[model samples]
Each structure stands twice: as C-alpha cells, then as structure tokens.
Target: MSDALAYDVFAKTCPSRGTLEHVTGRWGGLILGALHEGTFRFNELRRRVDGVSEKMLSQTLHALERDGLVHRDAQPTNPPRVDYRLTPLGHEVAGQLLGLIRLVEGRMDRVLAAREAYDAEHEPVTGRTA
Candidate 1:
C-alpha cells in the first residue's frame, strides 16, 4: 500500500467516504444481499427487499452499476426486460458485507442491552414515576 499524505473525506476525490455511503445506503446492502442469491429483475428486487419504492430501487441499482459492482443485462425481447447480477468484484465485496452483517446479528442482543442500560441510567425519572 502506498502512503497517502492527507485525509479529506468531504473532497470529491475522496472515494473512501463515498464508498462507505454507497455500501451503507438504504437499499444498497439489501440489494447486494439479494443479488447474492442470484440474478433478478427490477421488480423482483423490489419485492425481495421490503418497503423500497421504485425510484429508490432505480437509484440504488444505477449507483451500484456505476460503481462497477452490478452488471445490467438488457434483452431484446418485445417488452425489453433487464436483469441485474453482481460482478465478480461485487461478489467479493458482498461477501465481506455479509460477514459484517452476520457479525452484527450475532452481537445485536448485547448491543441493544448495552444501549438500554445506558439509556435507563441517563434518563431522568419522570414526574409520574417519581
């Protein structure tokens, strides 16, 4: 790895932050996870991931495609159906993401318990409770 001099996350040239935002986007993780299962069309993606609007799905897919993580295939059928699948690079990234998700799931209960404990300790007793 080359030694970089500065860290300006807000700069347009800083891909690190943008990449994190892209991967953590609302539909991004789910889209990657869904694609991990197999290739699917736009409608199928929407169906698999609950509560995603068409606009959001389109935007997410476009973003992933631009990032070179997703491959879009458009067939010359009458209706012009398109399918989306993960590129090899996307597969590698998705595998890492899945590992992260699995780790979070495993520790979620402990994390929640810690949050609740902290909140209960910090919160002032209401007049009714007092």
Candidate 2:
C-alpha cells in the first residue's frame, strides 16, 4: 500500500471520508452508543435512539454494517428475528465515542455559558443604529 493510502482520510478522493462521515454522523453516534450496551432488535434500537426516523435508522445501520463496525444477525425463526450489535472494531470506537459524550455532558454547563456570553455580545441591539 502507498503512503497516501495509509491515512486515506486526509485524501479528498479517498473513500474513508464517507466512512468517517457515517461513523460520526448524528444518528451514528447514538446508534453506536446504544449498541455498546449489547445486541438489540430494530424496534429496540429505534426506541433507544429518540427522534430517529425508521428510514434514517435503517440507513445508518446499513452504513455502519458496510463499514464493518456493526454486525446484523438474522435468526431463522417464525417471524424472522434480526438483531444488531457492534463488532470488535465497533466496540473500540464506541468506547471512544461514549467518552466524548461523557466529556460533553460534563462540560455542558460551561458550553452553555460560553454560548450565552457569545450571544449576549453578538445580539443586535434594537435601539442602536449600525
């Protein structure tokens, strides 16, 4: 493999950009975090992840699976059972993502305060002339 291929994410034309996008998208983080706990059915995942549409969930799952981060198991049963879980690679990344989540949660107060200060300074004064 070429040196450029070693870190393809930096390449504009590399496919890793799509993979990175999939892994870091809004629904992707939540889905990975949910699966970190254990395997869950489609409905269960949908419930675990709030405000995710059925189509979005399916698309995210498919993306994750294609990237080899998620495992989909189809059981041979009466109604056919399907479960989704993280692969070893998924677990590793999930742990990192969870840590990031915790960091944001812990610092939310500071973040909010900063946002408030910024807005206070930036908001246009109704009585002031530009």
Candidate 3:
C-alpha cells in the first residue's frame, strides 16, 4: 500500500478545510449548483443566483477558479464576454452538493418544526426572547 497520508477534514491545519469552506460558502454552493446546468456568463450567473451581489459573485468565481473547480473562459469580442463552467472536479463536488441541497430542501419542514418547538419551549416569561 502507498504511504500517502489521507486528508482529514477535521484536522485544524488541513488544507482541505480551506477548500471545503470555499466550496461550501454562502455563494460557492449556489454558484456550483448553477454551473452544473451548463456554462453561463457573468450576468447570467448573477441572475440565476438571486440575492448575490456582483462583488460577491466575482470573488466566489475567482476563488473557485483558483481552486481548479471552475473554468472561466474569456472571449475577446467587441465587448469582452466571460463564461463560467464547472471543471470535472467541480462536477463531482457539485453533484454531492446538489444531493445535500436536495436533502436539506426535503427536510426543511422538519427543521422548521423543530425550530418552532424549541422556540415555544424556550419562550421567556417576558414573551420577548433574545
């Protein structure tokens, strides 16, 4: 067997942790999910990912590209057009993320009910919970 050490996500200093954070950040997952459908231009991506500011989207794309999970293609046209798509690595990760998204969506009702129950049980005597 090879002596290569396997990556441990729980390790404090593991490089994968940073990558994990990048891939699963507020915008990263959405960006990857959108890209899974196919390539999209910058504006198209922004439109698809509602509520993401242009600055945040640009930053997220740059980070994903740096991590080799996204491919950005720039075309030299009258007006430069940049297209974004998922790399093979990104496709795999996005698939897993989609599964997670679906799971959370499917269970959101349960989560909401749990929250309501917890809030009701923990309601303050003053009726104003911090």
Q: In model 2, where is the ten-residue run with the lowest total lDDT? A: 1-10
Indicate the TM-score of model 2: 0.91
- For candidate 2, write residues 1-130 as lDDT tens digits: 5675476787898788998898889999999999999999999999999999999999999999999999999999999999999999999989999999999999999999999999999998788676
* Tens digit per residue, CA lDDT, model 1, 19-114: 667777878998898898899999999999899999999998898888988999999999999999999988988889989889999999999999
Every model's TM-score: 0.82, 0.91, 0.91
Positional deviation of residue 123's Cα in model 1 after best superposition, in angstroms: 2.8
Model 1 TM = 0.82
List of clashing residue pairs for candidate 2: none
Model 3's alpha-carbon lDDT is: 0.95
**Residue-by-residue lDDT tens digits, candidate 3, 1-130:** 1433677779998778888998899999999999999999999999999999999999999999999999999999979999999999999999999999999999999999999999999887786577
lDDT of each: 0.87, 0.95, 0.95
Off by over 4 Å in 3: 1-5, 127-130
